[model samples]
Target chain A: MSCNVDDSDEIFDDDDDDCSMEVCTKDSHHSGPSNMPESCYVKLTADDIVKEQRKLIQNVVELTKLPGHTARQLLQEMKWSFENVAVLYYDDQDKLFAKAGISVNGEAIDAVAVRGSSGSFVLDQQTITCQVCLEDFEREEAEKGMSTASGCGHVFCNACWVRHITTQVKEGQAARISCAGETFVEGKRRRCNIILDECFVEELLRGSGGSAEILKKYQTRLIDSYVNNNPTIKWCPATDCTNAIRVTDSFDPSSFDTSVECSDGHVWCFNCLDEPHAPAECSNVKEWRKKCQEDSATSNWLVAYTKDCPNCKVAINKDGGCNHM
Target chain B: MDLKRLKKESVELQEPIEKCGVTASPIKEDLSHWKGYILGPDDTAYAGGKFEIDIVLTSSYPFEPPKMKFNTKIWHPNVSSQTGAICLDILKKEWSPALTIKTALISVQALLAAPEPDDPQDAVVAQEYKSSIEKFKATAKLWTERYAKEGSMESIQPLLDMGFSEEQAKDALLEARGDVQAAVEKLLSGA
Candidate 1:
């Protein structure tokens, strides 16, 4: 008859439990936004995180799903992702790639690397779609060594770029290795201090102590960057419209702006428009604007002034009116 | 808006309108629209007469271009008789973003001195200008006298009798340089 606890004991115990549970729940609710939903969040051991990352990589592979020939060809290429990799959505016709949350370390990688013989890495079967040709590699004719700048992760084949960087440094034509997506400060080439790499590699090197040489190298590299990063500047790309946009970092070929100057002095910005520049620097500049007076004074399209119509009070702007008004 | 550049352009546009003796005054109440005047070019039939024109600034005023039409009526190869339409390159393909109102007005003045007969808005006048230069000059001169001269309409009854509309008659007389007889004869023949 007496499985029930005594009245005094039951009352005290129930009160303590109620207060503890309330405190616990309040704290949990307070930290709710910081935590992912249970299904999305798992306590990640170091190995578990790596495995989950691998699964994410698999998702990219599944998404791309290249045809048989393309997949095989990509496996033979040297393209690769280092770490913090994710799927980058690309629109081939426009040559635009959307930014995604998946990052390889702090830097974002578009390509993934597969380990090759003797610690070498070849392009992963999944990510080696050559952005240049806009097609998968079919034949592997050349073995071109390549590297990326630590600051801006632009990739380039050695044969096309190495001499240009060396010459700029030799001639004092450049101060740093600056490219479209990234800019490296002048003076010394740091060892491969990329985001994912924990230790500097012995093979990596920096400055030869020549400003001119660095300039030449960077300038050549900069052109390569332009070639890689900007496809919009080639033409208006508007259907059937034949306007071509001249590339300038600070200048508008259509209008004049004396204040904005391109870093290389090769381009100028106008009051009306701006040309292309290294994306990193260009994005920092504020949205393009023209003064109201400047635009009104310079615009070729005439605006008709409107007064409230006497009969209807509707705004009416007359196009070719004489001062007869 | 770039204030410095606008100031510079305003200065540039103002100087020539004042110097070339053209009407490039801004609207008193609004700077967006104004009336421009052109002293008909020297040695042309329109010479010795002053013509009024309207200039309206557009929303896309500087980048695209403002629309300008001659308000004054004169018999010219390129001006439309019915609507005072002006034909000029800046209004068409040669438009540039940097052009100012003064430069455009100056261009209109230059067009007055040398109307392009080949690209005429008034085909009949263009044909006259091309095939019979002297006749074209005389007709233009006569039209200037009747429509543009600034005397009085009472002295210009012959012009009113011509098929020229009443408004045209009045406008021609007002624009004529005190030559009622020439104005009347020209209006009769042209009408």
Candidate 2:
């Protein structure tokens, strides 16, 4: 597989050509279904995932005319499915925008407005409550008292928001945070997709005097969410390697002959993340390893005492010297 | 990094936990290794037994769920009788940062009251609980009497009055080494 060397180091750039070439050349000797040879495997470095995610976010931004955060909220809600997000977004955009927690054209929630006494019915409904502390800040105090973060439309006191952001960031949860009052409509088991805005979080963290360490963790966690949450990408399992692998299909570990390599000089099976121990199927290899573990204790003892019998080369325990039986 | 928020949060939680009649306190001064006990809920086989729980927290606490284990011998399906490891979801990936030590311990106490036999930490106990509920309850109550009956010995005299052949009772008692539970278990198996 290493024989087909190229000046361009990564499969991420020329995804299809490099992967097909490598897979076909490697598996050429093995006879199988004629159509099955194009192994759609691609490896992506950490930078590649970041670039793709940013590109995706930018694409969303351009399509919806929503700001980066609202686009993020929409994209996250859609689980990065751009087409579905676009469909839902273009259909009843106002409802979709409100659902994505954007109050004013994807801007941060500015205020909770109350109805004017002598009022138009449509604009009459006003007033907002912070979800975290469960406090209602009137129109005058609304700007100072109430702050909204995630796409769940849940608002909180600025102080409470600061604490929440700082603590979650410190806990390596900057990547995934939802409204604290988890009113899960579908179920608790299913992921609550309301993602907090990064800038809002960072701003709040700064307000609460959060250390640089937590902010760094927050940044790392953001990258992690980009790489790890995507079904296509997987962090290279090799210790001390920063690269990630992005396969064309979600590679099943049980499937035969998946040997992929990272840019940082590490080779492994994309399926089980083990060393590419081919010819031996994955399940069989697992069974063999288990058998070795259980048999090694007695095997070690037998190796110490027994010598090969001259007749058939079977291990035989020696009882006495100079006795050929 | 271990945040200072955990200390305040854990301390804040102590009141509500105590209100629930469960004892919870940090074993060490650092508020990392904690020790607590739950008085088994009413009407259950474990009712009157005080079950101890072991808790350990990393410095990255409130961010990470504390590792919890049963220090006392318990016969519940979701608690390992051998290792005392609990299989509760709150102590693992289902953990939310909003959940505090108090809520987590309370959940453990709840697990004792309502054991999820389907998803069990102790399979043997789960099997017994599922297949022979009557026998499982009897044995569980018997264990509670043997191990959790606070300094009280299972008196042999009570068994002597119940008409069992003198030889059988004495032999069972001898085999049990005078422990009422072991003797009862032996006699039940013998029968």
Top candidate (DockQ): 2
Stretches > 4 Å off in candidate 2: A1-48, A58-79, A83-174, A177-195, A205-207, A234-325, B1-19, B26-33, B96-98, B151-157, B160-191
Clashes of each: 63, 2
lDDT of each: 0.42, 0.61
What lDDT is reached at residue B17 by model 2? 36
For model 1, the stretches where C-alpha displacement exceeds 4 angstroms are A1-325, B1-18, B28-30, B151-191
- In TM-score terms, which candidate is top? 2
- Per-residue CA lDDT of candidate 1, range A201-301, in tens? 11122322324434444444433322223322332222443222223343333332222221122222222123433332332342222124467543223
lDDT of 1 by residue, B85-136 (tens): 8777566434433345665676787777778887778878888999999878
DockQ of 1: 0.01
lDDT of 1 at A192: 19
